[model samples]
Target: MLLVDCSNCRRALELPPGAHSIRCAICHAVTRIADSRSLQPPPPQGFYSSTHQHQPYYPPPPPPFTAPSPYNHAPRGPPPAVHGRKRAVICGISYRNSRHELKGCINDAKCMKYLLVNKFNFPESAILMLNEEEADPYRHPIKSNIRMALYWLVQGCQPGDSLVFHYSGHGSQKRNYTGDEIDGYDETLCPLDFQTQGMIIDDEINETIVRPLPRGVKLHAIIDACHSGTVLDLPFLCRMDRTGRYVWEDHRPRSGVWKGTSGGEVISFSGCDDNQTSADTDALSRITSTGAMTYSFIQAIERGQATTYGAMLNAMRSTIRNTDDDLGGGGGIVTSLLTMLLTGGSGGGLRQEPQLTANEPFDVYAKPFSI
Candidate 1:
């Protein structure tokens, strides 16, 4: 039996290796686990084969915590006046191919930048925000910004350091596989000019970026894409076409045709599924558009969900899935939401009325995804 948890949400379960699912009792959410051993070794690109190349993954060593600095949150006195810099890299792949893609990618990156700065407390100087035309988010020319981010992680990030990677745009499966799917692979978010003959695959995500994260560092990778049933929904701000009211697409398509798996030291909050498309809003609001998943994620951390990776992710999943709206079509959202709520373990922080758990085994309509 494998100790499995939702990569998108923080639902936990002891899953039999072959068993596809385990429902969350509280939220009635459904989650699918595909690839295991994804984080065993550090790979060069997306989530693909055993990218570690024989190097074993060391669960980052814990750093000693000394007195909190009066100025910064650092452990002790200011680092030797300049030990090393803590950095973050944010990249959005919007503007590739179509207007929709551009909108989504830009929106996705903007939201992440906010979380890193506003939520994670990273200083603006520490972050590198790379939108469409900007040269490099990670500095590598050939590899995607995500790849470059992973490159830094593999070489630079320390155990206690926090690193985040957020991507918004379009994503597909199997387009660039290292040959690991039983079903045809998936394809997603590529530049407008991304050559059809050669596309980026999920493997690149798993191998280079996800798998290579250094030990001890707490990572939160919030991905807004299709087929991301369990992913944290980033609220895409938009005006209701008919009412002209502000609205949020809190849910995306959560599906499974190909085998999906999870691993690594980081926590992943995906958007929708392979067959689904993330909701994109117009920039007319003049304010940054936020992914519902991202909004909830940051909120949870602020509420103390940062105590553990599992708690934080579950909070995101539960909130997004159960958000109430007058809009129609919940067939997809309901199932995914419930699964996330039930399976998501304790969100670390305890509210007055806790919802569900292995011991409680009770059910309730999850609270809304409001901030």
Candidate 2:
């Protein structure tokens, strides 16, 4: 009998002398055995071994790489504490040194971390940050690292848990082949390595952090990116007009893909409509440049303007609208030229409207906004 390891579970298995392959009863993995001559012990280590130099040494091949799957969750960790816990994953990709680099993404990340830690009472240890400045390779805002950070954000979440995902970066759209999007395009978050590793699509985002939420868990996603209105792929989109009248638009997938939380509540505040582009500008702040939506969102909260969901949304819109008006009117030629140069534009105008989407629809005015 020969002992070999099961390829999948690494369990030792006994093989009959003449058998070429054996199956593991424990894991049902099949292991193929090499020829008997090749299986013999390697020659003793000495000058005699040097005589076999004609055969080149070949090291074992590395482990197979599996592409990330939307449904493949991180390994389950210990259940969270019984009481409500707060955790956040804040990611900002500046694309530093590249043409796509933005001046305020790292700033956005730091501001968000400060907000969560100071105002919202989230522990610093519980927040996972991914940005260009992080010294740790695992914390860099690359495709795999970002995905891992997202998994860590919601792993072992239980009832009464509050989770937050904030991203300030370049967002783009790709053709939707899965038939899951109403607009026929899928929104994507571009990581540092997105040019090579590809963007993180909405389907994977929803599955990774949204779909697995448990009852009584709440999630808030603040996306400061272009074409991010429905980035979370939530089922209901809130459409509000200038008059403040609003209705929830049903955005459920026609292909019957589930884009909702299991039982938890999820709310997303995005930078703009699917067709609109978000701006990275210094117009909102005289001190430093920042993402328009991110700046407005933080300003609203810090200024105590976020009493209700409606109030917060209105405040953010008003802030951006005021900036737009100023830029179009008195900000003058230099400002306009700067805007064009920064945003890669034709010096026309900047029009961006913040958006809100949720797993379920309720009266925005009545519902008090919380993290």
Candidate 3:
């Protein structure tokens, strides 16, 4: 018998020999099993094989913590010294040669790097990029590499440091066992080896990058992925209406997981809500295919329309909405069918709305948007 944890509830269970799948008695969620024989090393040339597989669930170790105030309140810090530098981690995974391959993720990463270097004056050497095109084995967008990059981005960060994290790839959701998520699902990012190594969970993300920031530091994350809204698990979500009025919805974990930064500021721009799928299409950019959110964001900044947070969000939404109109109203039946086929009938049509989430509430229209 093979002992494995349930994918949903993390309950340990005994699997019969050669079992391909199992349903957890606790959560009743079916967990697929990969063939043990197929767990071979990658090719000598470092090219990944096309065979996709799911690894058995193993709950990650709890994030490190000091004694917490009652109800998971962020503790006042002995702030680090002000080291005002700009650094970034830009990751784009295309899942090359797989059935789940994407065409525009790499392009999105490249464009974002260019934008930061040119527009924001971020030093080129401070930016670390991870994609399939990277020649260094340590620079590939695998799960371990991505985790390391995230750690490097925040390591030794002090006040006045400006940091950015940009990701363009596939995002997914899994059943939330910790009861921290309002929607009962944990958001995840799929690395190149996700089929075997598993996805990077939001809790891990918050613990890694969000919790370590100092008071005067600021981080801006741009995620172009499906189901990415609040992927960083920030404490507040910005909800707005057509009239430009907005409110910050409190998304603090009732489970007291403490998703906030350490008195630092964090703002995230995602491709869509947690329930929606972001699009990868050529319609947004006539020159080359790219993630719609990434393309729209670049355009909004370049066109000088993103002077404030509200203006930036509105501009991105308008660009996508207009493109949807030009594509004959959300791509009609063909897009829906394709989405269904690609997502195993779990997704809907191509309509997507960009989302903004932050650690605290502020006047989005009044706050000057910065890196």
Question: What's the TM-score of each model vs. the native?
Answer: 0.48, 0.73, 0.72
Clashes of 1: 71
* Model 1 C-alpha lDDT per residue in residues 261-292, reported as the tens digit of each score: 12224444565444555444443231334444
lDDT of 2 by residue, 305-366 (tens): 89999899988887777654334223211122123223321233348889999999999988
Candidate 3: lDDT over CA atoms?
0.75
- The RMSD (Cα, Å) of candidate 1 is 18.8
Ranking by TM-score: 2, 3, 1
For candidate 3, the TM-score is 0.72
Candidate number that wins on TM-score, 1 or 2: 2
In model 2, how large is the Cα lDDT of residue 47? 26
Report, for every candidate in turn, its global Cα lDDT versus the true structure.
0.41, 0.75, 0.75
lDDT for residue 44 in candidate 3, whole number 0-100 = 50
Candidate 3 local lDDT, 1-371, one digit each (tens): 55444565443344566777766432356767652212222235534335533433333444344334222222112222222399999999888788887767888888889888888999987888999898776688987678767766776687888999999999999999888899999999999999988999898889878987779989999999999998999999999857768789999999787788888999999999999988875343322556778877887887788899999999878777755333322331112212211221112334889999998899998999888
In angstroms, the error of model 2 at 190 is: 0.2
